[model samples]
Target: MLLAYIDEIGQTGAFVSPTHARFSDSPAFGYGGFVIPAEAAREFGAYFNKQKRTLFKNEIPEGTDPNRWEKKGSDLLFARVSDDRPQNLRVFRSLISKLDALNGKLFYYAAEKPCGTPKETNTGPREFEAREENAMRETLNRLARHADSGKQQIMVMMDQINEKSRKQRLPVMYAHILGRATEHEDMRRIVEPPMHIDSSLSANIQFADWVCALVKRSIEYQLVPTSRYSWIPKETQLLRDKEIFTFESKLHLFHRAVDDICHSRILLEYRPVIDPLHTSTMNEENRKNLSESGKLHSVNKLEQPTNHAKAP
Candidate 1:
């Protein structure tokens, strides 16, 4: 069984509109983490804890606690560590190597925020929530594909949210996308309903938090050419070389370019309708014209028109 430990970097609050109050440093929202075999869960947790202790060497800071000592991807990559960045990097690289040895793969999905209209900003909730939902759907799609192929099952373990209501709401939201009524629900090879855990106690969640932060930083760099974040490239390359990160999958459907391309290609496979009234009806005049020219074929070839108005 595959277990995907999922986490997100960035608030779900929309920051797309320049005039919006929430607009800040982050330009995109990222959801990603790591996946491993279910049987290895306990072993992975033990190994991760050992590595964390090794990095800090039990030298607990005077004021900082164990939770604060826990290595974080953002802090390791971006913040100053003992005034020696290279040394900090070495420790991080070592930790990654240990993870690489476990043969786990990284899964990520990022959605670049879209600028919204004034009306949208004031009336409807922003697109950030929708993007998050799409990312989850795509993640499940990949997991489902694996389960279908291997005849195995999977589940998602996510970091706990601060909000009590959201903690319960997220699982219900997942059900809408993965439950029996959803299209391609078979792809929800993630059999168990998703559960949330305290990152402070769960080594798996902590490790996943680091990976999610790294992916989010990398995405921020990609989306903004002039961004000054440096160490992201080096860390990103290491993850890539390990062959653990899965990039550029079908879950990037929210990208306008991808959506447009898919639309154009799918339209070619269906007959184009010139008259809306004749969409379902066979016009006698056109039928006779075709029959006279020997161009008429079996009417059974006519496919029921799909509802284009509802196309995404």
Candidate 2:
């Protein structure tokens, strides 16, 4: 069994942007992917639960009422500081930093459009969308390379997004990549299981809760790193356009909050080789060779075809 832990980074709601009206106004697009071996899945789940407990206690104190917490809107969090924003840029940078720090090979697919693009506008082509699809294909191809030798099974889990437009992108992207995997006979047998968690029931709610707690911690501690701060650049840019200052500061704070949360939760280390026999292609090949050493079959051997003739 293979398990992929997936999460998306972006807003699924409609927002206005000067560049395009219909584009997802979400500032950044990101997905965190991890392929977990079958035997390790349950163990990882338990580990994740433990981590969650620690995070909750650290962020929300033990006696606090968890029911009072609700998912905070990213936009709303930044709104007080800037009518237009710079916070998203900080969040974007932090995400990139976190991705860079991740230890094991992780597959990431992201499409980021400038904020404020309306959902209805029919802009011609989106470069970010193309980039995201390409990334997904490349990642899938890498996985298929290992899978073709019967080394690994593909399993994925991801956070659900709200935009109907973006919802279709993932499966289509997967299909395109899988099409290229046809060259490997073993790759042809790979199957993608239906997505496991329902957004309304379990995973989504849990993710929202996690984000909320993180955000609150950010706000309480003013934990945004100075180096990661968005103001340094925005301060310079604002000299040319004074109007940006008002929104930039607010956006910066909001993003700093997001950065703090993201930095803390990023998965650092994970053991990928769970089942040594299945995970190692070389081992499997050696085992197969040994098993087939004495086997013999006629070159023309074929099972008789089943007969269910019609009255042709």
Against the reference, the lDDT scores of all candidates come to 0.57, 0.36
Residue-wise C-alpha lDDT for candidate 1, range 37-96, written one tens digit per residue: 777777878877776776776566677656535666677556333245676656556666
Candidate 2 shows a clash count of: 9
Clashing pairs in 2: 6-157, 16-116, 17-116, 17-117, 21-117, 21-118, 22-118, 82-247, 87-251
TM-score of each: 0.67, 0.40
Q: How big is the positional error of residue 64 in model 2, measured in Å on the Cα after superposition?
A: 11
lDDT of 2 at 186: 41
Measured with C-alpha atoms, the lDDT of residue 280 in candidate 2 is: 29
Q: Between which residue pairs do clashes occur in model 1?
A: none
What stretches of model 1 exceed 4 Å from their correct place? 16-22, 58-69, 79-84, 115-126, 167-171, 177-185, 247-312
Query: Cα RMSD to native, each candidate?
Result: 14.1, 21.5
What is the Å distance of residue 216 in model 2 from its true position?
20
Q: Kindly provide the TM-score of model 2 when superposed on the true structure, using C-alpha atoms.
A: 0.40
Q: In model 2, where do residues sit more than 4 Å from their true spots?
A: 9-30, 58-128, 146-150, 163-167, 184-190, 193-196, 199-312
